[model samples]
Structure formats: C-alpha cells, structure tokens
Target: MSRPRRFLPSVSLLTAFEAVLRTGSTAAAARELDLTQGAVSRLVQNLESQLGQPLFLRERRRLIPTEAARAYGRDISRALDLVARASMELAANPGGGVLSLAILPAFGTRWLAPRLAGFLSAHPGITINLATRLKRFNFAAEGFDAAIHFGVDDWRGAGHLRLFDETLVACAAPAFLRANPIRQPADVHALPLLQIETRPTAWPEWFRAHGLVAPLPRGMLFDQFAPMTQAAIHGLGVALLPEFLAMPDLDEGRLQRLPGAPVSGTGSYWLVWPEARADYPPVVALRDWLAAETADLRAREGAGDGADDGDRTRTP
Candidate 1:
C-alpha cells in the first residue's frame, strides 16, 4: 500500500523544512539550501499549508519550531542521513558488489583484517566495507549486509555461520605478575581483575570453570578488549583476554600468562546476515570462506583437544 500523499511530503519541502528547523531561521536555511530567504520561507509555509498545521511560531521576525515540528525534524534528519549514505554507497559502487560488514573491534583488527586480502584477491569485483559494532544492531536500520557477532547463535531473524569458539587466557603484565604472583586458581580473585563492559560475567565464569566459587572484586572497566589488554600490559590489573588477542603480547614477553589453564568463554563467534540477504553473493562468499578458514579450529574444538592447555595456539 502506498503512504498517504499528505504524510509523504516532497523531498524538497521536507529538506527545506528540516533546514529551517535545524538552522533556526529562513536566512540560515537559505544559505544552507542555496535558496533565497523568501524562497525558503515560502517552502516552509507551503509545507505547513499542505499539512494543514502550523510548524513554527513567528515571534518578532523569529521562527521557533513547535514541539511537534522539532520531533518530526529529528526523524527527518535521520531519514535524510540514511538517504545520503545510500546515495554515496551507490555512487561509489556503481557495479553493485558492495558488502557493508560490521565487526568487533579487536576481532576485526587482530583476526579478520589480516585475512581479508585473500578474500578481496579472489573476488576482485566485490568491495568489502567494514565498520566496528561492539554489540548487536538492527541490520535494516544500520544498512549492513552482514556482521561479525561474538556470542551464542541467537540473533533473531538472521542466518548464522559458525566461526569459532573463544578461549580466554588470564594474563597480566610481567612486572605485575612478579609483584603479585598467582600460585593457584583462587589467587586470581585476590588481585585486581580488569573487566570488559560487554562481558560482565567473564571473570566469574572463568573462576567457575576452574572450580573456584567466590565473589569477584570490582576492578577497572573497559568498553573494548584493545584498551583492556593495554591496561593489563601497563600493570593496571589482571585481565582475562581472548587467546587470539593475548597471543602476540604473550609471545613478545610483554605479558605473562597467569597461573591457570585457558578456559572456554561463554559464547562463540559467528558471521550473521539478515534472512533477506541469505542468497546475496558477497554474504555467501564470506560465509563459505569463513567456514573453510575456521574448519581446522572448529574440528579441534569439537574433538575436545587441549581443553585446559595454556600453551596451545589458537587462531581467530
């Protein structure tokens, strides 16, 4: 069904009204829209006449938007931004093989970025645009073709491709570990434990996995793993980092593994796409590539090998 004509005003009228609402005056809106002040005023007046409602209050030659108009302007602004982004994407990729993918910060930089070259080389015609999304988002609203999701396979209305399970290693700066040595599994609780905002239960689950049952202490909170890993390297606190993320630091001797075995994290990683794009060429290519890429790791995990080995190497 088509939208009511009155509710769906012309883009020009909406742009003019939005500009006036944003710029505070017809003169400023005129400057922004590259129209005469009189023309801009006429546009807003025309919109008001079409809608049969007053959008602005004329007070001493000043235009003050009504509350309803302000609210409407906010929605219009978002819509305009979405339209502009879509336009730009189309302009940039006229041939139409653009894949806008959202990724986790650490995983994208440490894991996927290094391996993207092979995918790009194989599919030279496809362009992959990556954006960092630390948490779940609406695919339709966000305008993403797919996203790297780190959790259980529970994203509603989306298709999932298993990547790999995450293994967490408790690590700290070498100096900090020397100063506060960890001799047992319970010793981790005695020290300041860094926390990731998204994984609030990580420390507790790690402790539980090691057969330790104690209330965890509050410590430094970080929104992402990159900074938390840096904080741990700087002797701020002991952090439970993903094995893939902590491997370089441990290998370079910047951080030492705390006295414990690597524990399985709460969830696994997945490549998720909306159901509508289930057959999208780029999504299918990426899904197949990821499945093939992580086949060995997934097999190892399935076979239950190295369940408690801290020295085992794992790739993301």
Candidate 2:
C-alpha cells in the first residue's frame, strides 16, 4: 500500500520548495529555514531534478513558481502542517490519546464545559483539546477529531450523534421589560430586538409561531450569543436565546421572559465526526459519554416535556 519512491519527496526538499514558493525568493526561504541562500537553491534544484521538471521560471534575478508548481505547493503546505501538528501532539501527550474538538462558543462554555470534567475523570488516559468554531470546516484540512454542530444532520461524509434540540425563549432585561411592557407577542416589535448572526430568521420564525407574521425591524446584530446575552442584561434589547443560556440570567432576575411561550429553534445540537474517524477510540469514548449525558434531555424532548402549550407541536 506504500506509494512509489519517486512520488514521495523528502521532508527537506518539500520544506525548501514550499518555503521558496511561499516567500517568493531563495534568500527569504534561507532566512526562514536558517540555511544559506546557496543551500536553499541547491535543495530546490535537487527537488526539480528528482521530479524531472522545472518548478520555477527564472527571470533576471527573480524566481517565479509555475502554475503547476503553485498548485503542488498548496498540497505540500497542507501536508507539512499536518506533519507538524502530529509531531507536536505526539510530543505533548507521549503515551496518552488526544482528541482535538471544535465547539460552538456559547454551547461549549455553558453546556459542555461544565460536564467535561466527568468525561475526563472517566477516561483519564484521553486528553481533549477544544477550539471555538462557529461554522463548518474541512475536517481533513483542520485536523479535528470531532466537532459540536448546531444544525440539521447535513454534514456530508460525517457521522452524527444527536445531542439535544434547543428551546428558545424571547427575553429582555428586567428593567427594559418594566419600561416597555410586553402585553402581547406583537409588542416585541415596539422595542429594539437583538439578533444572533447564526440565526438570521429567528425573530421572524418566533413571530410566525405566535401568529404574528410580518417583516421585523432590524436591530443590533451579534456574531455570538455570549455578547448578545450580555447586551440583553444591560437593557440593550430583547434577545431570543436558548433556554439553557437564558435560565441562569432569568433566575437571577437579570432578564425576564417576554410574554410568549418558548419555541423550538431551527436546529438541534449534534456531535459530529468525519466518517473516517467513526471508530477512533477517543471519538468513540466521547460519543458514548455524550449519549449518556444527554439521555435525560432526549427523554424529555421525546415526551414533549421541553415544549410549551403554544408551539409545542412544531418541529425544529
């Protein structure tokens, strides 16, 4: 199953070629690699000899990479990054397993972070590293073992495990609500409305669920829920927030639920991994742990416990 010897370039040759292509000169590549200019030029020449083609076009004193060489450099750069990441991980965790997970910011901080200790306690040999990623990414290029996805199960070539559906509550600061009382669902439009960037149609959808269908006024737009939640706490505007995110603030009297029933958001939470990593040991362990952790929420959702009287029947 090994590739032909000619197809596999040495790391030194690849590094030199990639550096020259990226830096646009052998002098710059030499500075980066801490090698003399002549040494770097030699490495490039050796690589070209091995490949049986000229990768660069010499004009005056400049070296311009050919179009084909530019494309090949892109692949080489990715391969080098992968190798570096692997080397770093191996050095950091020597004998232990490492799982690099991409997570949604609010969900990671409010939900998963609190319960992660239990998972780590159960599997002491596994180390989980988390990074915030708000949108989908190329798994092969990013080098993540798994990601926390908040949407429909539509990640092609990835295996999904349902976590839980989110229930959204329209809420505002207690002072703001007292200042502009919400007597009905339509009253929400009278005040400033905050919107999360990820959920563009949330306000419209929430209004439609309450039998009030019309174009909504644009308000402040936030990229993440954390800042939006804080803005609502400071009486900036009413925000549609997930119940889990809003519960603590509501209980502490920082925010008050608007005069409307809770409605299901347009998406559900999921633990997704590339199909190639479906059976990875760390991934499998985390999947099993998440399934157990979300069992209660799943049960409540199935029994209609998470729904309200008004929009309980609507699917997420």
Candidate 3:
C-alpha cells in the first residue's frame, strides 16, 4: 500500500557524468566544474553505481564513454541549454522579458524593419531581438518566441495569424526595359526571366492569369529577393518581385514594371508562434499590434490608386 521511493541521481552526479562524457576526461571535467579531478571521478563513479552501469571504459589514463553515455549526454545537452537560457533570462530581465523573433531577410528589411520602431517604442520594457531565418525552424529548440513566416498556414506545431498576401510584379532594370521593350505579357517569354526558387510557378501563373500560355523556360535562379532585386538592377534579367520589395528600386528609377497588371502570388506573410504560448503577453502584444498594422495597411491599400502599385497590390 506504500508508494515506492523515487531514485533520482544528485545534480552533482549528473553534472559530472555530463561533463566527463562531453570532455572525455575527469581532469577536464574537474577544470570545467572548478572541482578537484578526484572529486569529479568520485562523482562519476557514484553516478555509475546509482545507475548500476559503467558509463565510461577505463584504458590506461583515457576515459571513453559507452554508447549509452553518449546518448545520455545528447539528451542532457538540451536540458542544460534550457537551464542556461533560463538563468540568463532571469539575470537579463529582472523586471521584464525578451521576445526573440525569426524573420525572412527581404520581408524583414523591406516591411518589418520600418514597423519595428513603433513596436519597440510602445513596448519599452520588453527587449526584442530579431534574427533572419530564410527557412522554417523548430521554435522551442531554436529559442525563438515568434517568427515572420511566409507561405500557407502549415508551419507544423505553431499558431499563425495571416498578415498580408504577396503580390508579385514583373520588373526589369530601366536600361533592360528600354533595350528589351516588352509590350505585352507574351513578350516576357522571349527574354531571360529570372526565377525565384521558392515560387517556381510565379511566371506561369501570371501568364495564365493573363490568358497566355508561357513555356516557362528555366532561367537564372536566386534564393532571396535582396540579391535577386540587385541582379535585376544590374540588368541580369526581368524578375518577378514582390511589389513592396521592388518599390524603392522603382522609385529610384533603378527598375521598371514590365507591361501588364501585377498578378497575385499564392503566399502570404504570417505571424507565427508556438500554440502553448498563445496567451503569453509578449506574443499576444505582437499579434494584436501586427493585426492592427495589417488592418491599417490594408485600408491604405484599398484607398490607393495604381500610381503607387506597391500599396495597392495584393495577392489572391
């Protein structure tokens, strides 16, 4: 009828085991833990005795971890990281917390950077850190509180709020446009059309939307728009660029829109965070502020004329 006692290893024993496994020697582990080498050895021996297994193989002066110890070290690595992060957070934000965000490079620079000042101004107590991540990542493992994600609402294990759809317009450098002189959507097929690896069907979809059948030949491929826009400006070829990313170049007379109306791409930007942190204050504040900003931008877009195509454009 009595409950069985739980047998948990002491923190020192676990730390010694992890340190020895990581450094491959008790001496190194002792140096790392700031303890005597004899103490570290005793701790590891105690841990092995408690677990009833040999964590290390003794060969002369060398200590080699068994496969089981190797796996255990890997498991404890993440736990140790979380502990360190928690300690650092406690030290850094005694009065508040930090919000770490992962963002796409082009979108972050062109869109989010301009708006981040307002967010920081309002949330003066919270420290906001931004890192550029071109691909989706594990939020918990990477220590991100939220991310600016593009594409559909399919980031596995995260809750997403749609920010804005992407509108892609065909663009070329002014000199390239002058020399190429594309008159209609069909004229684009004859030129070197730059392609974005993420959106392979952009050109074909645009052509289809305009009632034209494009062969959609392969062209020079670039991963991100910052470089792709630069390539287009340097007269590499015409590129299908998001209207917002292309605006500065258009205004500076570095790039020009190819003949035809801008077509909608099949993706949108989303503010994504882990579902478990849905009600967390920082995440909620960011989500609500983003929603308001998106609504205001949409209202402006709706009221704008074609003169500022960047503001007026939206993807389907």
Task: Put the candidates in lDDT order, highest first.
Answer: 2, 1, 3
Q: Name the 10 consecutive residues with the lowest summed lDDT in model 2.
A: 307-316
Q: Kindly list the per-residue Cα lDDT of model 1 for residues 1-316, writing each as its tens digit.
A: 8899988888899999999998899999999999999999999999999999999999999999999999989888888887887788778877747888999999998899989999989878788999999989987778799999998667888877777889999999999988998899888877888999888888888888889885656789999999999999999999999999899899999999987899988888888888878788888888888878888888888735433211112222
Candidate RMSDs in Å, in order, are 5.9, 4.9, 6.0
Summed over model 3, clashes come to 0
Count of steric clashes across candidates, in order: 0, 0, 0
TM-score top scorer: 2
Q: Which pairs clash in the backbone of model 3? A: none
The top-ranked prediction according to lDDT is 2
lDDT of 1 at 67: 97
Pairing residues by index, what is the TM-score of model 1? 0.84
Local accuracy of candidate 2 as per-residue lDDT tens digits, 1-316:
8898788989999999999999999999999999999999999999999999999999998999999999999999999998998898888887767899999999999999999999999999888999999999999889999999998777878887778888999999988888998899998877888998899888888999999874566679999999999999999999999999888899999999998899989988888888878888999999999988988888888846333211111112
Q: Per-residue lDDT for 236 in model 1?
A: 96
* Worst 10-residue lDDT window, candidate 3: 307-316
Residue 190 miss distance in model 2 (angstroms): 1.8
